[model samples]
Target: MEALVLAWPGGEHAFRLPLAQLELLQGATGCGPEFLLNKLNLGQWAATEPFEIIRAGLMGGGMDAAGAKDVVSRAFDRHP
Candidate 1:
């Protein structure tokens, strides 16, 4: 599958959500991926949604666990 490249505070990173990651995301958010997508589209997403999505996507895109968490932390600190 194609990856979505996103620019974080540190640098650009490729993000993807395979089935496994999506399942994890759903569990984390207590909602399905479709509902999350809808919330994002309508600009009504909770703060944790973007964080969870980005972290999961980064992992799915082959980033190491530490690296993904660091990137998300720095990015959200600046942008949030």
Candidate 2:
């Protein structure tokens, strides 16, 4: 599966990823704040709080409205 990596507006890192990539990362280091942040960018969420992002991820795992929101939120927060 193709993976997308998007970084917060100014963040050095990138977010956005495919399920396969997510799974790979999970196997490696588990879900850390950084990983969540990256996913948030991919989803295009609009919040910064970890819980909010987590919820977004859960709701948007399928890459629906919720997931987009989470990704945007992460990007917005990271944007500097």
Candidate 3:
């Protein structure tokens, strides 16, 4: 899968959805990859889906668990 690099609050970070992350995401959302993607595309996701996806992707992109969680927390806040 391709990595999604974005300019976050502090700096640019790369996020990815590998198999392991995908599986975790599926479990968290109780949906398959296609369904999840569709939901995201259609803007039908639940409140936590985006956060989960970003956290998982950050981990998949080689960020440590704590770092990923911190980044997701900061990025998902009310700021831009």
For model 3, the stretches where C-alpha displacement exceeds 4 angstroms are: none
* Per-residue alpha-carbon lDDT of candidate 3 for residues 12-50, written as tens digits (9 for 90 to 100): 888888999999889988988899999999989999888
Predicted candidate 2 versus true structure: per-residue lDDT over 1-80, tens digit per residue: 33234333433222344455455445444465476568777985443344444334433234564555555666556653
The local lDDT score (0 to 100) that residue 49 gets in candidate 2 is 47
How many backbone clashes does every candidate have?
0, 14, 0
By lDDT, the candidates rank as: 1, 3, 2
TM-score of each: 0.87, 0.24, 0.85
**Model 3 / residue 5 / CA error / Å:** 2.6
Instruction: For each candidate in the order shown, give its overall lDDT on alpha carbons.
Output: 0.90, 0.47, 0.87
| Deviation (Å) of 42 in candidate 1 | 2.2
Candidate closest to the true structure, highest lDDT: 1
Off by over 4 Å in 2: 1-62
Between candidates 1 and 2, which one is better according to lDDT?
Answer: 1
